[model samples]
Target: MTFREGCWRRRLRGEWFPGTRLTLRALASELGTSVQPVRDAIGKLTVERVLVLRPNYSVQIPNIDRELMDEIFAIRNLLEAEAARRCVSVMTDADIDDLEEAILATRRVYWVESEIPSRVTTIQGVSRILAERCGSEALCEQLINLRARTAPYYAAALARSDDGEDAEFVTFTIRIQDEFVTALRRRDEVAAAEIRKVDLYTFQHYIYRLLDVE
Candidate 1:
């Protein structure tokens, strides 16, 4: 990948904090590259809304707000529901097995503060698998980009260490994932799509609560 793309990848993956003030020279020095590539990277991310250029000559992560969060969920619901619907007919025994494995991995990390990222990744693995099996590359690409944009918010939500709260979140996630796998196993496209929609909105609500935005 180009240095610019690599820089964009890191930012989207939540390597940078939400309010971090980034300068071209600083990033270039940190990435062990020239300022030109870093400048190019910042320009691209600024266009993507992943980064915003300030009047003060700095780049920063976009501050998440209610409107942005709602829009993200709306798009996710449409694309992910369709992906789940398409996957029902094509999913195999091995696909179900992989999803179960992902759930199991998530279960193992229950309530671990430091492992929240892994938990989020494991939960996401199911949909990623479904998207791959669904035969729609455009839909898959949109879902992936949406996930990258929202992953940091998910990580922040999952990192909550409130008493009994993380357990509840984990239980909620495992239950929905189990239901989704069961729908896939039955080849019930309608059920799979509906369940996936509920799952996405449910998690989105949880994250919204974590952000105190809803």
Candidate 2:
């Protein structure tokens, strides 16, 4: 991708910042490129469900219903905790090391004043690897789709905090993920399952607050 194209995609993914409604021209100007690349990138992201195109051709970062958002995360918890638990017997030393590395990387970025999308991407990247290593292809795909369904959930949470994601939320998430890793290291299936559920519900809680359901 052109630097301009890459930057535009990054913004759409909320890598640099949370985005609202943005016109193609405005995005093009910021990227310092012509409108063509912006248009192409926008089209691509829309297909990825990363951007929603309005009737007037303006693009928006997705905003989803809070109830549905929470439900997706719950599904993710159910699918992925089982996957991780199952994968334990099959996990090699290298796989364990990689998981440890991902955990550390997540901790490093947890409190950084970076954009939420980038942070979300980092979390998901490691998770995808962990999920895929599980013996079940079907479970892996389900977890991936579940994660993707949370795109709007992440967007809404980032926006709701207004000043950006609070240190408390970040720290809580890092701690939860670490507990999950600990469970994995110990081959404690029940503990792993519980920690994963906490991560899922805590994420749901953010949306619940937004919907005033909590």
Worst 10 residues of 2 by lDDT: 10-19
Whole-model Cα lDDT of every candidate shown, in order: 0.74, 0.67
Q: How does model 2 score by TM-score?
A: 0.65
lDDT of 1 by residue, 1-214 (tens): 7766775556444555456677777777777888787777778777766678877557876676678878888988989999989887777788778877876765665544455546567657766776777888888878877776776676666565364655686678779878988998998999989999988888788777777778
Clashes of 1: 0
**Per-prediction tally of clashes:** 0, 0
RMSD of each: 2.3, 5.0
Query: Cα deviation of 20 in candidate 2 (Å)?
Result: 7.5
Q: State the lDDT at 99 in candidate 1.
A: 70
- Give the clashing pairs for model 2: none
